[model samples]
Target chain A: SQQGEEDPQALSIQEGENATMNCSYKTSINNLQWYRQNSGRGLVHLILIRSNEREKHSGRLRVTLDTSKKSSSLLITASRAADTASYFCATEGETSGSRLTFGEGTQLTVNP
Target chain B: EPEVTQTPSHQVTQMGQEVILRCVPISNHLYFYWYRQILGQKVEFLVSFYNNEISEKSEIFDDQFSVERPDGSNFTLKIRSTKLEDSAMYFCASNRLARGYEQYFGPGTRLTVT
Candidate 1:
């Protein structure tokens, strides 16, 4: 399987604290994407970092990619209670098209 | 502000019964995909469809599994003779082009196979 794995499978933090999730994959990738899923809801696209890019940010979410290590990280800064969700990292393999292999995901809980 | 939409948010069926999960992807996107999560596990890719045919699929998408566009706006995943292990959340997703970056997903359909 080309799927990657995520670390810190579950996390808990107080509101306003920062939450960071890490993902590691085995193969060379064209791009990596981050997604957030609220309980029992659809996944919302968070960010996408191409292989050539090292870092990207959107609103309170920051994503970093290091191709040499085959790893990526997502940082949610100043997280609110509503930020609680399961975050996954999906990789688009160098040769694959249209299908993305997803990580197990990090379950984040922000307590108010 | 368009998002993917799925019908029959939850389904309960007996083993050996066939069930079809329906999805309406974002209007302009051309590539469509189906993924399933066996509760507590990683989301696994089932299949990808484009230009009225399958572009790619994973091992999990066996002979019992099939996908179709059927029309301009709807994409569907059909499970034939579902087994107990088939119980999972099925998610429908789409992106603008191949390589499938930045996909938009529909609220998954929870399938309970009894």
Candidate 2:
């Protein structure tokens, strides 16, 4: 696994179902952020959680960080067809000077 | 909402040719960065610029690559001589804070080298 690696590289689910993606990293980070990317498009910022923060939420997205476990999870509840996109978790190292190391990303498909 | 904008959505250039991918980050953002995705691969960082200078860069950003904020609004990445493997989607991103903040990315410039 790389610095940031997301599990379940691909996921498919019903429109009203929930989607959960997990990410793990090896190094200590100052903050972790999730991004959504439609195929061949730009990245959309989802949420950011600092190392000291355990959880954060925005709209239908919930992000949890467990630094002790070096892992994070993004849960999209009551997902809709428009929620279909690739989700990536990126880490900013404590001393990396704004460099964001991104995970391979989980390809999510919400079938309506 | 303010968003990052990039130019020439698609650029096709021959190997060894010079190509500059342009970007206009959010007006209020202070930090700028360049990243690239080689097709199905993960997005990789290229460089981060702040205060009109490069703050950090990745190993992949070699001598052939250079970044410049020629003016107040535009940030550009110039690949002096393109390589076959240089074919990838280049994304420009910006953020208001140096850390603990989300970065906004542009639609990306797909550079196809032949």
Candidate 3:
């Protein structure tokens, strides 16, 4: 299926704390991307990490990819109430063309 | 700064009826795609279009589904017959290249089939 599976289906944290979410996929991928969706709104792209890259960072977001384990993790440092949203991990398979197989996503709630 | 845009933010249709969802991608982007997310489910890809033709499509994009780029600016997805299960949030996305880059997504159209 090449579907990405995310763990910790939901997480709640206080502002100024850190929250982490993990995802595991079944097949080889070209790249993995993280996206955030606020309630029923559109998805906002967060970060992209290639298979060859082990880690990357953007602002308060940090992403790590381990091809050997076919797993990835996203960490949001110093979380804010505004950061409350559903975080999804999507993977572009090596042979899947432009299609992105997404995980079920982790619902995050950051309390102020 | 260009982003994807979709029309009819919300649509309600009866089962067996046809519906067409519209989208206008980023001006310079060449690759366009349609994806959907059922309530509380994962986002699933339906089709990918490039150069005005379908380059790739998932099994979910069955005979009931069709895509077209009738004009230079608009891309459309038509469902021959809506099923109750077809109700979902449909998102349109686009990218400048075919791969390796993030695809910009639209606000999405919520289709409610009754």
Better of 1 and 2 by DockQ: 2
* Alpha carbon deviation, residue B44, candidate 3 (Å): 0.5
- Cα error, residue B82 of model 2, in Å, equals 0.4
Which candidate number maximizes lDDT? 2
Q: After superposition, how far is residue A32 of candidate 1 from its true place, in Å?
A: 0.5
TM-score sort, best first: 2, 3, 1
Q: Supply candidate 1's per-residue lDDT for A12.
A: 97
Model 1, docking class = high
How far is B96's C-alpha from truth in model 1 (Å)? Answer: 0.2
lDDT of 3 at B68: 97
The candidate that wins on DockQ is 2
Candidate 2 residue lDDT tens string, A1-112: 3777998999999989999999999999999999999999999999999999999999999999999999999999999999999999999998777889999999999999
Full-model lDDT for every candidate: 0.92, 0.95, 0.94
lDDT, model 2, position A106 = 97
The fraction of reference interface contacts (C-alpha pairs within 8 A across chains A and B) present in each candidate is 0.89, 0.91, 0.79
Worst 10 residues of 2 chain B by lDDT: B95-104
Candidate 3 structure quality by residue, lDDT tens digits, A66-86: 999999999999999999999
